[model samples]
Target: MAATAPSQSAPLAALSSTATELDVRDMVEALGAALTDAGIDGDLRGSITLAVSEALNNVTEHGYAGRAPGEVHMVVDLLADRVLVTLSDSGHGMPGGALPPGLLPDSSGARADLPEGGFGWFLIHKLCLDLSHTRHAGRNTLRMTFPRYLAPEKS
Candidate 1:
């Protein structure tokens, strides 16, 4: 299935959910709202959302492709000066069992070369302050952090 930005789900402030197309959107939105409600700035929320969306999208479109069912778990933790998002899935792990090094998208690529859609990981790498990936016991886990002060407060 093609990927599109997901709609907001009911306010759940979710800690975890099954990683399915039917539940991904709601989980993302609820998490986003929870962050903002906790006093994190909107810019940070957007970056986190973009990164999380990309991660969840990958889990859906790549890991669980062919509509195969699996568990994709998300856990958000708020620290004193930063937020942590940990995502886990029992589907296929990232190619080579680790994140590629310095894989930020090349913006200089020509228009035709840009037709392929893989900007998600690039944004995740660029936006996230800290990113860690590990595959253990058939579960692939990603942990990313964004400092609370990185995003400026809204006017």
Candidate 2:
């Protein structure tokens, strides 16, 4: 389905789909396009894409593990000074219903012994200015925001 149209005072984009790798990729791509259309690019755009992609991947892989894929809803808003993104799902909540501390995994071990995973949340935290998660009534909601980003002024 097409993404929702943006309004000056409303969300820049909104989309919903089953939580799957393909769908998550599509959502991320759509979001990137929306950000580009809104004159957002470079590092800020990269961070938003990475964080949102990781969150959606987690929902598909962990939240819906052993069950049918669940629905994931995403809304993005580009304010004058920041970008706000909210993702929600009716799948399993985070362990203990709390956000992960997002500490970087230990990398002092041998190359082969290094972690092959566990960096998603860390990267998300590092890129976002703020992050939050909540679970209530069997739904999980994740909210993240990034600092100002706008296309460079044309000469």
Scored by lDDT, model 1 comes in at 0.75
Which clashing pairs does model 2 show?
none
State the lDDT of candidate 1 residue by residue for 17-122, as single tens digits. 6677668888888877888787764688888887888888888878877666677878777665777788888888787877866465666878777636667777
Give Cα-based local distance difference scores for all models.
0.75, 0.86
- The candidate that wins on lDDT is 2
Error of 1 at 67 (Å): 5.9
Model 2 residue 137 distance off true place after TM-score fit, in angstroms: 1.3
Query: TM-scores across all candidates?
Result: 0.79, 0.88
For candidate 2, give the lDDT.
Answer: 0.86
Clashes of 1: 0
**Residue runs of model 1 more than 4 Å from their true location after superposition:** 1-14, 102-110, 152-155
